[model samples]
Target chain A: MSGILHIAGLGPGDDALVTPEVTEALAQATDVIGYIPYVARVAPRDGLTLHPSDNRVELDRATHALQLAQAGARVVVVSSGDPGVFAMASAVFEAVEREPAFESVDIRVLPGITAMLAAAARLGAPLGHDFCAINLSDNLKPWAMVEHRLRMAARADFAMAFYNPRSKSRPHQFAEALDILRAECGPDRLITFARAVTTPEEAFNTVTLGEATPEMADMRTVVIVGNSATRRVGRYVYTPRSAV
Target chain B: MSGILHIAGLGPGDDALVTPEVTEALAQATDVIGYIPYVARVAPRDGLTLHPSDNRVELDRATHALQLAQAGARVVVVSSGDPGVFAMASAVFEAVEREPAFESVDIRVLPGITAMLAAAARLGAPLGHDFCAINLSDNLKPWAMVEHRLRMAARADFAMAFYNPRSKSRPHQFAEALDILRAECGPDRLITFARAVTTPEEAFNTVTLGEATPEMADMRTVVIVGNSATRRVGRYVYTPRSAV
Candidate 1:
């Protein structure tokens, strides 16, 4: 039996936000692998094995999926948002690069509604203009690099979306990020914190850079720093199509 | 009859890519409004009126939707990709900001798979790292702003996704933009042109910055320029998770 691996995105926390393609992939999968929460999202049924791994063990998880697929298990690697964005697609490809034998494995990356887009939709179109998406987790990269990108994005007047901000292990970094934004984008620029987006526990708050506090965000939050042109229209915040 | 407006994304021409939320919005819509092509994507139904307008009249179309919604019609404004990204969501909000009488209209922006993410998934995560999305059309913004942002994104070593990169009226601008990218990112940088992504006529091609010509892209294409760490693994091009 030939095996294929599908790296699929579950799309934020909403079932309605998930694409039909991902649904079809999950339906056809004999094995599903991902973080505990993501794997738990898949319904359990006969002939399907679920493998839920711990966080930060992405490489090991990817390798396990690869091995399972090689053994003729139709595997689907699940991610909360778009698999390509700071998620499992990169990890799977990284594994393939390290293991030449897995290079020939049939792999497909499915796209989904990323957290930033979902958060942006909840708060109006804050990313309507040019924007940048940065994974603020310092696990794979340096804080200095994040700072540099934030400065450059601000200078370019691009709205910014930050993922994995203000985790319990790295709470102070988000404060530093806020400081950099205040310095580069000024205090009045709109900043949005969307926690548990598209879920039942979802909460959205919009504040200016000066009014924002690091305590307002957590690992579950996706932060959106609006461009210079972003402002409130009635109760909604949106960046205009034209440049400031 | 309370009026409402739903700005929805059709997700790059694939019916499978259209989220259930957006599909439900379309189904409940009393009137579907957008550019001729996007409106054509929505099926014609007995109660739903299709208002297909010409291109470049986003504000007028937005106004029409607002007016219809104010008249107690359930209006759905459709865009090809995510409405928040260089699409109609901002236009509708801009109209809201301009006309206070329509401020009470209940409007919700539903997210979908943006072209860049779809293209990145197809090309195996070229935007796996930090990235910027810019609309290279110079229709609303000046060419200088696009050039400046391009330089900044390159200097920050961010992967870049460009929307509306070329058109018949501004053919030379894309060539000029390519030259800027070549200068800032160096000639060896990988660039992917994904045209009509996720559609039946979809096409994808990857080339080095030095080899990419302006003619390779058109209005339908979403162009992705890889970061310094981006490279080919087998037939796929992906930006590494770790910074170099």
Candidate 2:
């Protein structure tokens, strides 16, 4: 039996944000597979098999799901935020490519509100016009690539939201990134430091890249750096293309 | 009875993207109001009133809604994308500012996906990390400020999305913006041109910014120029800082 793979997007920690389709898929899935933290977000449902694993082994989990699907299990591969946005969707595709028999497999990717958009919304739409998203983790790609993007983004003057800016092992990366940005842009570009946005523990801050050092962020943080068009109107940050 | 004010975010054209809450609110609203096109999207329910006007006359509509609310009629302020992003929410706030008596009125902003996020999702995670959105419409703001932002975003090398890039009369503005960006960044930067994204008529072309001329984009387009880190892997455009 060829099992259909449904990659579900669990919107930024809010059950209300989950679409009816995603909810229905979760309710019907024989096996729910995801990273441990993401798996914990789903409440218990009867007859559902939960396959949770650590974050370190992503491909392994995808392979396991494919194997289970090949065994005729109705499987749902879940990811926090959109599954296609740097998540399980890629892994599933990679695994599918490795096995030709999976060619006939029906794969559906249901989109979700990514953290960048969620953070941008909470921060008053600094992302209202042009923007880009860059992960600061240098685990897979070289930091050189990250720096190059940073330089290009700075030169391009796009409003930016950074994910995985800082982690335990790489504590000072955000600071370094800020330094590069400040040099390329200027000191006064409005920047927002948003953590756990839309979640109950959501916290937000406004600063300049000049003020944003590594000490101010972590893995939980999504940094928003405004373009030169961004301005400080009272306490709020807005990028006005038209004068009010 | 003080009439309720409904501020609706019509998600990026996909009817399925409309949340259950939005549908319920739209159904319940006695008077539906918005820019002409947005008002046309939701079909008239039984006993519903429709108020459609030009896109730029937001404050006027908000004022009208307030007057209707004062007259004990429920009114909705509808926008094609999220109400907050360069849309009706601010106008509602502005109208409230004009008539402080309406300050205590009940207001609800239903969240919908914005065009930027929808476009980014279609373009393959160019928005997965950090980014900015900027409008090229300069009716309210001077070209100097817009130029400043364009220069700054280029310098910062952030992923950038441009909105309201051009119209019939203002044909050359986006081209001028492109010229500015080209001079600041290089011709080799990856650019994704998305028009009518997520809609049935969605059209898209992804190429290097060097390849994108102003004629290729218009007011209907949402343009994304990738940071140096952005790469096209197969059909996907992704910028990664790590593998996992």
Candidate 3:
């Protein structure tokens, strides 16, 4: 018997942001797998077992889910935001590539409101124009590549969203990123730090590239740098639809 | 008493993909405003006035919503996908900027599953790495700017999602885009055209830049151009987490 393995996004932290498709998938799953915090969001039930793992072990978690589904345990791998955006969907796909026997497993990637969009909603459409989303963490890619990409994005005048901007270990990289942005985007360009968005702890600070500090961001923040035309309308920050 | 204005996203087209927050907003709305198709998605109920307008009248629609809210109407302006991403949120903010009197109106932007993320989920994590979303329509921006941004994104090796790829008025631009992409990213690079995503009409096609044609895309299609590291892993396309 073939069982399904669903990679689902739980949105940011709010249950109201969760899609009914994901809710239905959770209800049908026999097992839920993910990082500790994400799996913790799923309600435990009589037939469903939750497997919560730590960070940096995405491959292991994905493999476990694949193996369980292959053995007829219906599984769902949870990610905080959209599974395809630097989340579990890619990890599961990578696991499938590693083992040819896992190719036949039924896998579906369900989308959700990612942190950047959620923050953008609360901050008022900073990404209302052409934009780029870059993962600022150097754990996967080279630091130089990040710099190069940031420069390219700035030169293109694309609004930017950055994930994993500042973690304790890579704290200095975000500072360097800020320096690079100050150089490329100018001091007056808008930058917003949105933390724990859509949660009870949700907080936002909108400042210019000149006013922005590295300390404003942490691991839980999603940073948005507006394009050349982005500005404040009343209390909200948004990039106008039409280009100048 | 003050009425609230909720700018919400209805997700792609699936009722199941709509977020609970958006659903709740609709249930509380006394007036719903949006383009004809999007307004049609909302269920018509007693005491709710559905104002379906035509496209390209975004500013007018936004102004109407604001006026209604100022008059103490519980207004909900709907957009397909996330309102913050090239949608109604920016337009509303633009309207607010135009009319200083509308400033005191209570407004909130709610997030939804944007088309790119939904398409990426269905296509198996094509945007698993750093990516950009660009509006290809030259209705707002100059043609040269679009070309320049495309070149920059290609240089950055950023995966890309393009909205409003083609319409009858500007079919030639997408053809020009393909030529530029072929020159910059080369013919062998992968591109996926996903149309009417998350709906009964949803369809997908994954082709290399060499094999692609302008006819593959339309206004309804969201095109994804993979990064250099993106490749096929079994039936799915993914960019690996670890950068080489």
Candidate 4:
């Protein structure tokens, strides 16, 4: 029997948001692998085995999924958001590159509703204009690079979305990010902090760059900074389609 | 009877990619309003009325939807991709801002698998790292601003996604944009043109910056330019998650 490896996105912690393509992949998988919380999102079945690992072990997890697929096990690697966006898809490809034998494995990346878009939907189109999505973790890239991108994005007048904005390990960096934004985007720019979007724990807050504090964001939060044209319309905040 | 408005995404033209949330919204919609093609995607039913309008009339269509909703009609405004991403969600809010009487209208924006994300999935994660999405259409924004954002995005080394890269009215501008991209991103950079993604007529081509021409893209295409680290892994193109 030929085995397949599918890197699937569970889509911001909502069952309704998960695409039928991904749901169909999960139903057909013999083994499901992912970070603990994501893997736990999958229901246990008679023939399916779940392999949940700790965070930051993405490479190892990808390798294991590849090995399982090589052994004729239909494997699915899951990520919280779209696997292609700061998630499992690239890691799987990196593994395939490291081991050329895995290159021939049937791999497909399934897209889903990413956090930034989900947050934007809830906040009334804060990213409705030109935008950029930056992963602010600083684990993979330097803090300097993030700051540089932030400044460039501001100068370009693009609305921005930040993933992994603040964590216990990197407490001070988000503050630094906020400082950079205040300097570049100025005090009046609107910013939205959407925590645990689309789930029961979902919370949304929109504030100005001057009013925003780093503590408002956590690891679960996705922060959006609007372009110069973004503003409040009734209870919602949105950037106009036209630019100045 | 209270009225409601839902701005929903149809997910890059695939039945399977459309989320259950969006499907449920369609089922309950008393009227569906959008550009011709998008409105045609919704099936005809006894209670549902489809209002198809021509392109470049976003504001007019949005106001009509608001009017219908205010008249106690459940309206769903459809966009081909996520409504919040260069689509109808912001247009709807812009209408709301213009008329304060519509403030009481209940509005919700449902997310969908946007063209860029769907294209990235098919291309094996070209946007696996930091990225920006720009609408190259000069209809709303000035060409100089588009050029400036291209330079800034290239300088920041973010993977880039272009929406409405070329249209019959503005043919030469995309060539100029490509010229700027080549100058900023270098000749060796990789670019992918994904036409009609997730649809039956889907076509994907990955070429170097030197080889890409303006004709590779049209209104239906979503263009992706990879970061410096992006390279070929087997038949796929992907950017590694890590930065230098």
Candidate 5:
């Protein structure tokens, strides 16, 4: 029996961007496994088993995919955006190490459109230069570490793409985080709000740090805070021509 | 006759990654115009009028594309990798402003796989977060500006993607740039080199700043300097986990 593990990228939002490679991988898979929402993006088909669960339960899904792969089934572990960027790739690797049975399994991760690229494309290239991505979600890590990195990026004048900026349970966290960035970088910095990027309901708004104030963002929004060089041109916001 | 300008993305290196969207646009184009090399990437198709020119002559190509659009020809302005990132999109806008006759023409810039993303995918996720792209070619800019931004990115610990890092005549420039980064970001800062990524002769190598000298890179190489938080795992290098 032959077993291969394919990690597919579901793109940022729209299904149209799902590459031919991803669609081909999905078609050949005996088991399609991913975070619940990611799994739902593909159509249900015959001879395919769907394994869906919460995003936090990555280890469980990896183990399940490993088990399926080891059973001589072509298993595909899917993730929204790119599989390698904070997605199923690491968990799959971790599972491979823990389970010697899957050590030699053929694994390849197909690149997808990451949310950072999607958000940047919508905001007129706020990511034109050096930047950093930081997740404000404290569910798995400490807020102190996140804060330290944010401050460092601000001081370095790196543009920032903030993920998990806010959720209902932690609604005020983004505002507090904005305050911290404003204190370190100054209030004149540019903040861009990209909501439902690449989706039909896409909306964009750019403002100063003083105007951002948490109210402009939501859980679904990707917040991009421009560095010192970022500027407004007509309706679009972008980093000005680099002196370099 | 509706005049249309299609800015098509020729994916990084390999022609297969050229999405169906790009192929479709190319098929419909009557005038295929862009930089000489980019124009050469497409096969000699019947009924396609080709307009190719020098690298520094971007405005010239955009001007010609706009003229073709004004003449009611279906024009496809080509750019290697993505149209938006340091490519034809900006030039198209510039041409639109310079010649008001083409202002009413509908323009579309279809996204292509950027070299940064292609290189990142091949060398793990150095750009897994916010990052900046800086062109090291000093044809239109001064070296002082490049050094300043490099110093800032190094000090602030931003992941950096470098374009035109080195060439035959100006080979020592990339070395000097690396020296500044090494001084500010330590000799052990992780650096990933991607040459002709997604092409038949694709090459990937990861080394520390101490190991990266000017000789290691050339015009075709896209260099990535991982931030302070980037770490090495065996042969792969990656930034801190990005969650969105």
Candidate 6:
């Protein structure tokens, strides 16, 4: 029996934002794996198995998907955003690297609307120019490296989108990150905090770095900091294509 | 008469990658405006007027869309990828800033699978970690700024994605960019070229910096350069979630 694995992104929270490709993939899938909330997004159906796990067990979950696929079960490892962007695709690939047995299993990644892009869309193209996406969580990387990246991105004058900006595990680091950004980019830089974008609870707040507070961001919020050229026109914020 | 404007993404060239949000917006549109190829992607109907324009005229196209909307035409401005990413969203907002009459047009940008994310999905998550997206076309920005961004992105150790990596107007600049990248990122760095992603002419190639050539990329290609921790697993390439 032959089986294939698809690392698919369901896109932010809205079903409307999810792609037809992912919808099709979900339709054909015999097994779906993801975090608890993401797994809940899929309707329960016959002949399908849903394996929902905790967030931090990405490696174990990836290994499980690979194992299921190796056992001739069609598997889909679902992620909320684009799977390749700090999501399940890397974990699955890393799992393949660690276990030689999973190497031969067929795997493909399907992209979706990542959180930053969804947030950017809501915030009126704050990332319209050259930009960087950084995950602010220190779970996998060091805080110092995060600080270094923040400084370099600011110095380069690139618009920035930050994911996983603040969480219960490390609330204070976001405060430090805000301080670093303020020091590097100055008080006049525009920063936007978008929480639960596209969902019922969606909210957006744009302010200068001087007015931005660490309390504005949480795990659900995606933060975007504009470059020197970015500004507001009426209610919209955007960065011009040309450099300042 | 109430009119709304949705600057929407078509998601590369594949219909399957297009989001339902954009699809619904198109269904409700009285006028659809975009570049020639992107506008062609929308299906024509009795009530909808398709307005396709040539390249290098983003501002004019944007202004037209706003004018249509201001005249009580529900308009959707289509872009190949996420409209917020180096596409029509910024142009529309800039138009609003230039003309006060266009400012009150209710505008929404719908996100899609951007080329870099789509390319990363095909290449097995090379942008799995923190990454930056840079448009290499010098039509809108200075070459010096592009070069500076490349160096800063390299120094920050961020994985990089280049859109419009090469064009007939600036064929030689990509070669210069490759040289700068080689100098900053070293010859052993991994680079992947993905052409017309998610479309019929889709092609993928991965090579090291030492082996890469400027001729490898074109206007149709999205190029991704992995960070230090990126490597190949079996036939797939991926960047580990953990930093090196």
By summed lDDT, the worst window of 10 consecutive residues in model 4 chain A runs over A1-10
* Candidate 1 residue-wise lDDT, A1-244, digit = tens: 6699999999999999999999999999999999999999999999999999999999999999999988888999999999999999998989999998998788999899999999999899999999999999999999999999999999999999999988888879999999999999999999999999989999998999999999999989999999989999998999999995
Per-residue alpha-carbon lDDT of candidate 1 for residues B111-187, written as tens digits (9 for 90 to 100): 99999999999889899999999999999999999999999999999999999999999989999999999999899
- Per-model fnat list: 0.90, 0.29, 0.97, 0.94, 0.15, 0.95
lDDT of 3: 0.94
Ranking according to lDDT, highest score first: 4, 1, 3, 6, 5, 2
- Which parts of model 6 are misplaced by more than 4 Å? none
Best by DockQ: 4
Give the poorly placed runs of model 2, Cα more than 4 Å off. A1-6, A24-31, A43-49, A59-76, A83-108, A119-195, A200-244, B1-6, B66-74, B94-108, B144-148, B178-189, B208-215, B241-244
lDDT of 5 by residue, B94-211 (tens): 5665566666776766666778777876665566543567778776567776787687666545578888899887877888898898889888888888899888778887889998
Q: Write the per-residue lDDT of candidate 4 for residues A161-208, one digit (tens) a residue.
A: 999999999899999999999999899999999999999999999999
Candidate 2 C-alpha lDDT tens digits along A43-132 = 877888999999868778878887887888888888987775667766666665567566566666666667766666555446544466
Question: How would you encode candidate 4's per-residue C-alpha lDDT over B1-244 as one tens digit per residue?
Answer: 7799999999999888999999999999999999999999999999999999999899999999999999999999999989999999999999999999999999999999999999999989899999999999988888999999999999999999999999999999999999999999889999999999999999999999999999999989999999999999988889999987
Error of 6 at B72 (Å): 0.5
Model 3 Cα lDDT, one tens digit per residue, B1-244: 6899999999989899999999999999999999999999988999999999999999999999999999999999999999998899999999999999898999999899999999999889999999999999998889999999999999999999999999999979999999999999998999999999989999999999999999999889999999988898777888877667
For B70-131, candidate 2 gives per-residue lDDT tens digits of 77888887887676566776566656655778766766665666776667666555654445
Report residue A127 deviation for candidate 6 (angstroms).
Answer: 0.4
Q: Which 10-residue window in model 2 chain B sums to the lowest lDDT?
A: B235-244
Ten-residue region with minimum lDDT total, candidate 5 chain A = A235-244
Report, for every candidate in turn, its global Cα lDDT versus the true structure.
0.94, 0.73, 0.94, 0.95, 0.74, 0.93
Would you give the TM-score of chain B in model 6?
0.98
DockQ of 3: 0.92
**What DockQ was computed for model 6?**
0.90
Error of 4 at B97 (Å): 0.7
List of chain A TM-scores, every candidate: 0.99, 0.94, 0.99, 0.99, 0.93, 0.99
Model 2 lDDT, residue B213, Cα: 82
